[model samples]
Target: MKALVVYESMFGNTQQIAQAVAAGLGKHVEVEVTEVGLAPDEISAELDLLVVGAPTHAFGMSRASTRADAVKQAPGGTIVSTGRGVREWLEAVHPGGVGTMVAAFDTRVRAPLPGSAAHKVAKALQRLSFPEVSDPETFWVKDSTGPLKDGELERAERWGADLGLLVNSR
Candidate 1:
């Protein structure tokens, strides 16, 4: 199966997780890892699985409040939309029988408590009719900049491998 891993990272913590996911998935199937700023039109329709990840902000997926404070960010309407990285990528595709295998994951700081980016991205994917949706996953970090805590990358790898198995079974 062909898989794509897209991610938005501020201090490279999320990117590391994305790479780990790609590595784990690559062990079982062909995978492509890319930054989330890819043009919507650039998204390939032939992909069998789409995995998206981002850092959580403002108790949700990069909501507008968190994004706007940085610049004119916000992929969608919220920081979650911050340029619509995950939203646009999924939206740009015309998933037929196989796109239903989409999965979502997110990275967040484990302090003061907040939301998960995976939930936001998963919800967005579901709205577009991606079937057999897997549960959203969360990876914790030490602080805002994030060292990713412990065993997070290993967990990401496991998630990737498991997700690959799910798509391959379909």
Candidate 2:
């Protein structure tokens, strides 16, 4: 099976998780990982699974304002500006012919929040009639510009592997 793992990260924590997840998924199937800005405008018909991830901002997906705030918070202007984020990409993409095996994930503070980017992304995909293979998943970060919570990368990899197994069983 083929899979695509796309992500948006402000401080790079989410990107790390995305990479780990792709690594895990790669063990089971051919996978391609890309940043949201570089992702294809349409999901290829040959794909079996589509996984998306982003950093949670203000309880949900990051908007222009939130992204600007994140860039300002970074020390020494370390974060480079990536014009388009997952939110924008999701809003613009045509999900009509996308695969049904969709999954979403997000990186956020450990606090129990009412919303997450992952959840939002999953809902958006569902609106286009994509069947989710699993519930939205959250990976914790220590702070806004974070080193992810210890072991989260490993956990992400395991999650991807499990998802791959799930896809295979279908």
List TM-score per model, in order.
0.80, 0.95
In order, the Cα lDDT scores of the candidates are 0.73, 0.87
Considering every candidate listed, which one attains the maximal TM-score? 2
What does candidate 1's lDDT look like per residue over 1-170, in tens digits?
Answer: 78888887766778889989998889787999877766334445677878888877777666445556634432332322236555455557555553546778888877767567788888877776776447888888887666799999999998888888887777
lDDT of 2: 0.87
Candidate 2: tens digits of C-alpha lDDT, residues 48-165: 8999999888888989999889878988656533779888888777663655589999999977667789989999888867789999999999987898999999999999999999
Please give me the total number of clashing residue pairs in predicted model 1: 16
As a TM-score, model 1 comes out at 0.80
Query: In model 2, where do residues sit more than 4 Å from their true spots?
Result: 96-98
Candidate 2's displacement at residue 150, Å, is 0.5
